[model samples]
Target: MADSLNCSSGNCSSAQEAFGLSEGHFALVKAAVLGCIFLLASFSNLFLLHALWKRRNRRTRTQLFLLHLCLADLVVAFFQVLPQFSIEITHRFKGSDLVCRAVKYLQVVGMFASTYMIVAMTIDRYHAVCKPMVSFFRGSFRRYVAISAAWLISLAFSAPQMFIFSLQEVEKKVFDCWATFIEPWGGRIYITWITLSVFVLPALILMYCQIKICAGIY
Candidate 1:
């Protein structure tokens, strides 16, 4: 039992190592905490999705973007985060190359999709308030196009991770499934670009739009 509770290798293990707790105690605690989080996230996302779908009749621009955001978060929670919890508990990845790549791809796609949805929301609000000449991007067709474009863009950005990561066995010990950079600094550069594009750029745009909105209101 004590052996079972000991830190296996990755995140939970690291925490236990840091806290100086016995493997059994901390492992159960980690498992319980993670299990609760998974359940709460799953239920909350499902409810949000259900609520969004129920309000489909209203289908405003904001609603559409929010629906997509909920879907993206649901995908991340189920396809990426849940599977990751299992890996964190075990402290190793033993899935096939296809499985690994698919999971990693979905993870990246979900992240980018969520980020782009926020950007879409920001742009929509900005255009509706500031550039009324451009119109609020109404109609079902335009909304579908916007959604399709967001997914396509997310897919294009996430595709590189699919190709870069493969199941590489290290020293016949642990199987670590992570992105393999071809160049020395390739991974760092990729992450930095992703961070900037998905987070920083959208944040800046949101801030600019907020300022414009304030100015317009005042």
Candidate 2:
């Protein structure tokens, strides 16, 4: 019985060591992946933006949306992915409270902008296909309005992130950028709201528009 207990303890210690090692490896992999994503997104978006600019005179409404989408994606690549990559490499956020809050705010801004831009583009397509006459008459005005609304909404919605996140001491002196919520309920409600806004609502809108588009096509 004593021998068996000793063997079990030894095995547990070994398993813990293995787990720690694997976690370190995972962190490196995550950093590498994020770096690749940032690079690819930046390069591709910039190239596309330049191409679009060259054809500015002949661009369509869809192309305009795409141009803004690329801008939003570049924001994600710079503010979101690049910061995350740096955090992964450093193993923690290395910034002041204001910097942390700004990063968090811009991160969500990019997400919101990207999501709503897609929604706007899809709705534009829906209008073009299903309500061609209406689209033709009001397309220019509505296109500008949709793009502006998407950006304004993104900025407004992301404001909370700036207030919620700040640099805090996680250890004796080691600080990290963390979000402070009002215990359990705050976290849950905030997450639910984010999910609904960023994923669920947009998904539903996209789905509805796509269905209508298909029906119109048929």
Winning candidate number (TM-score):
2
Tens-digit lDDT string for candidate 2 (132-167)? 999999999999999999999999988989877878
Q: What lDDT tens digits, residue by residue, belong to model 1 across residues 35-105?
A: 77778877887897788889888766777787788888877777766766776577577698898889878
User: Candidate 1: minimum summed lDDT over ten consecutive residues — where?
Assistant: 1-10
Ten residues in a row with the worst lDDT in model 2? Answer: 1-10
Alpha carbon deviation, residue 62, candidate 2 (Å): 1.4
lDDT of each: 0.73, 0.85
Q: Considering every candidate listed, which one attains the maximal lDDT? A: 2
TM-score of each: 0.81, 0.88
Q: Which pairs of residues collide in model 1?
A: 5-23, 5-24, 6-23
